[model samples]
Target: MNLKNKIVIITGAGSGIGAATAKLFGTHGAVVVASDINLNNAQKIAGDITEAGGIASAIKTDVTQYQEVEALIANTIEKHDRLDVIVNNAGIGGKEQLKTAEHTHDDWHNVIAVNQTGVFYCMKVALQHMMRQGHGNIVNVASLAGLKASGHNLSYSASKFAVVGMTKSAALEYARKNIRINAVCPGFTHSALLDQLLAVSPDMGEKLKRFIPMGRFGEADEIAEAICWLASENSKFITGQTITLDGGTSL
Candidate 1:
């Protein structure tokens, strides 16, 4: 889709799906703000976009902290003078979660802080601006685990479920404000982190694939495409929806 001159802020844009989405948006003529806790990586992405004749900038932000996220939006507006899109893509799956009785409390807190609270912060701040401007697009990156219970990753599942719920509730509240809100729930996808895991245990990657109806992991760019469509004018009528791109894993 043509995103000519649209101003987009993407959190966790240093790597994985966030990076892919930022690059894709830049390719389509959007001015991209690539924010991540890892400043160096974010800078690398921004540099890549600049080299390719796209407008972009890197900003260090820890979405888990409200002040940092607020500053991110402030800086974006100060530089761009407007916010067209905010992608709440900063999230964490945490270390493997045990059963209710065995799970560490810190793991639950950490996961919820980043995945749930962080999304809330981004949405709250962006809405204040979007409401005044009379239009915007907000896309929160949820997960297949959000739609279903993950016995082994309870904290991650809980955090993402909250994201889906937030997306729906917020979307309803702002449906008529010309601001569209939605969530993208993806299944097991290939990424740098997944690469590290597969490198350590190659067989586990193949084994996990059997459970997906598509018999393979979805690509990061595929998920980015869904996000782009939802943010584009083509899907202006699509709000308050959870678009699942999980290779039918939820089915």
Candidate 2:
């Protein structure tokens, strides 16, 4: 899959899957716009790409705010004259894990605002531009939790499931317009988010690893490869589907 000269925007590009993806796309000849809530980290990744002779720019953005998302798209157009691809990868887990009945209002609302509503903001603006241009691609970073229920991650699961539904619904509407929309559901990936959770319960990682048929957690680059394919011309006919990158754990 070739992404040469593609103007790509990746949110949560500071670390983990997003960072890995930004680098991969850069190497594939994309002009990457890396956005994250943390300006410092975003700049770091962008700098890394630049040092490696890749084109990139960093923008500090909070996806929950519609205006920021609007500006993110606008800025990309201002810089590149077109928006070619977007990876809605910014997401958060509950501040504290909670059961369905125990979820706090703050935790539930925050998770949905970032994971669900954030995707909506990016897609809405991107579709408007893509419709006018008559071509574009959007890839959302959902989770395996979105596909199946997991205890104590209620807020996150709810937001991701909404993303799954939204991906399909949007794909169907825009397929004829040449705008392909899809989602990636990553399972037990070794990311900063996973490390933070593992730090709290060290043995949990090993316990979770046992469930995967491959007996391993996915690497960030592995997930990045899938995102790149979904955003590339190679997936010209693929849309409205959730590509699960689990190590056969769901089966």
Candidate 3:
């Protein structure tokens, strides 16, 4: 599906899945607004997109902060005049050293603040604009752990699970208003952060792969493709659902 002229905003566009999605969308002819907590990283991605002859801009935003998120959306609209799509992808893996029972309140709140609450905050403000225009699409980047138990990574899993829950509710709420909302569940995608996680336990990586019938870790591009499809007219009939790019690991 073509998204020529569409105005899209992608959080966490500095790296990983978000970065991949922004480039793909820009190449597909969408005007992408890349937002990330890291200004340098966001600017680099925007530069790459521009060099490739795509329309893009970088916005440094801390998704967890309401004021920052509000300003991010406001600035996008001020620049483009309208917003057609929003991908809430900014997130973290949460405190690594802490188990469920050992997690500090600060760590737990921090993960939820960014991963779950941030998605909701974005949707709330995005829909305000979308509802005004009477058309829009939203895609939340959740994780496979949202669908099932992901022992040891309690806060991240919990936040993602909340994202899935919120997406379903929001999707139904806006469907009649001519807006579609969905969630993407990706499994063990390779990212710059993967090496650090894998170092914790080499066996965990192997264990994750074995769960996937494809016998390999998925890539960020793989997940980005699904995000694009859901955002485009190709999947107009789909809503209140999640597209899993887990390589059959969820099977």
Candidate 4:
């Protein structure tokens, strides 16, 4: 688990699980490149890491834009000279914006653009770099919605399902090339996304926890731990798999 001097690029690093993961990786001695559409938030997170004596840099990234994603990857490589880990965690929970089939086109399109296409773009760029390095780790942050149906969450589920599919395919294609790809499917994690979902269905949050049997929502750190492990050599033998950190909710 010693990631000293490792170069890592994390998307959606502005807030929520992505932010937590970025900080965790940085704290573990990884030189982290934290990217987010919100440049301010990204800068703040990177600043905090630096203040704590962790190596980190911030960059503005619109994951849906291939050019932006490519630039982010290129910048990371330019600054660090090599990329060791890529965490494609940039995504949106459309549980609030995308309510039904008849929802606004803008809402639906935005979710798909950010959640699905963004992941694809990140993987493509990261893989290109990793292929040259002959070794890399890719961890895509998917969701339980990718595995099960979550009503009123059309765009979010669709995007996550696509991510799961892409992760599996990429993993198989790169297994022999020394590149590992995996997905972490979290359920009912505490974040802005969850807050939006809860706002829509106040009691649903409590009900959702009941289904987990653990009777509680998960912490962002819980998911971050999974990402960190998957990104490490400890998971060298693991790939093309989706690890669920939902306190047995999917069971």
Candidate 5:
């Protein structure tokens, strides 16, 4: 991937896919701004990259807050003088598996706030800068649930569906402006998010793996590779598409 010297921001970068992507971006010679709600984790990732001879920094951002999202973009631009790519990878799953009728309002709101609304905030703020700069790329981290039906998590499904929708819509709106927007829909990836799911239903991992044609969970670095490609010039002509990395489970 030709991400050399690109100034990139990744949300939810404290761990999992976000952390993997940040490190990958660093390796590709991009200036990585690892943003997360957890400042310590973000700092650690940044520190590791710096130690490895890559340029990186950590920014504490709660994506659910618009002001904080704005500050993230503003600070990056103020320091880097240009915003190249932003990976809206921050998201949360439902607390428990429940059917629509049995889903609690609080869980629904919280999930939506982080997954959908938070993505919107990042895009809205980043777009302003990109539009002014007349060039940029966006890679949103949606899920396979966003592409297909999720059995029991209505909020997560709905919010990710919104992300897919927003990615395509914005891609079209900004296509002529030299801005590209795309998404990666990962299925059953081995990340903290999946661990949380498995923690809730300890026996579900094997059952879920059985459905995948590959018969294994995806590694976070695998998804990061795709994200880096999408953000790089190699995929410059691609936009408004959701690349699925699900071990063929969605097939």
Candidate 6:
């Protein structure tokens, strides 16, 4: 994919699929803006890209905060002169394995804030700049739960389902303006978020793996590849679509 000189902003880029996508985009000649809740981790990823002879910068952003999200876009535009693409990859999982009745209000609101509302904030800000530019791309990191009923976590599922809906609605609204919006629904991927779950239930990984026909957990890089494609012109005709990379588990 030809992403040369494309200014791309990736949220939650400190680790997991976000970090992997930053590195991949850098290698493909995109100027990567790595944004995360943790400044240190974002700096490390940005530094790694720079060390590899690619251009990148780090910004600390809490996507759950609209002001912070606004600053992230404004600062990127101020430095780069134009915004090309935004990967709404920042997200959080709620209390896992909890029944609907067992899920707390705080957990639901917190998950919705980061996963759903946060995406809206990023999209809202980026859309303004992108609309003026008359061209842009938006790649949202949703989850398998978003595409189907995942009894794992009520709040997480609800929030992600909202992402899917938002992506499609926004894509149709912006298609004529030369902007594309899409999402990726990854299933059973090995990410820091998943590691946290494993920390709590060590055998969960093996149990989840058994459901996948591939019999292995996905690597972050695997998901990154798809994100890079969606951000590139290679997928110019594709929008309002959720690409699933679950190793046949969804089947």
| The 10-residue segment with the lowest total lDDT in model 6 | 193-202
lDDT of 2 by residue, 1-251 (tens): 78999999999999999999999999999999999999999999999999999999999999999999999999999889999999999988887877788889998999999999999999999999999888999999999999998788888998999999999999999989989999999999999768866876869988888889999999999999999999998888899999999999899
lDDT of 4 by residue, 87-129 (tens): 9998886545445766666767898999999999999999999
After superposition, which runs of candidate 3 have C-alpha atoms over 4 Å from their true positions?
Answer: none
Candidate 4 vs. true structure, TM-score: 0.96
State model 3's lDDT. Answer: 0.91
Clash pairs detected, candidate 3: none
Candidate 3 per-residue lDDT over residues 1-251, each given as its tens digit: 77999999999999999999999999999999999999999999999999999999999999888899899999999999999999999998765756778877876889889999899899999999999988999999999989988877888889999999999999989999999999999988898545656878869788767888999988999999999999999999999998888889888
- TM-score between model 2 and native: 0.98
The prediction achieving the highest lDDT against the true structure is: 5
Tens digits of per-residue lDDT for model 1 on 1-251? 86889999999999999999999999999999999999999999999999999999999999989999999999999999999999999877656536778888888999899999999999999999999988999999998888987776788889899999999999999998999999999888888645744664659898778889989999999989999888888888899899898888887
TM-scores of the candidates in the order shown: 0.96, 0.98, 0.97, 0.96, 0.99, 0.98
Tens digit of lDDT per residue, candidate 6, span 1-251?
Answer: 98999999999999999999999999999999999999999999999999999999999999999999999999999999999999999999886568898888888999999999999999999999999998999999999989888885899999999999999999999999999999999998899778877777768888888889999988999999999999999999999999999999999
lDDT score of residue 179 within candidate 2: 92
CA lDDT of each prediction against the hidden true structure: 0.90, 0.94, 0.91, 0.90, 0.96, 0.95
Query: Can you write out model 5's per-residue Cα lDDT over 85-168, one digit (the tens) per residue?
Result: 999999999887899999999989999999999999999999999999989999999999999999889999999999999999
- Model 2 poorest ten-residue lDDT run: 193-202
Q: Is candidate 2 or candidate 5 better by lDDT?
A: 5
For candidate 3, the TM-score is 0.97
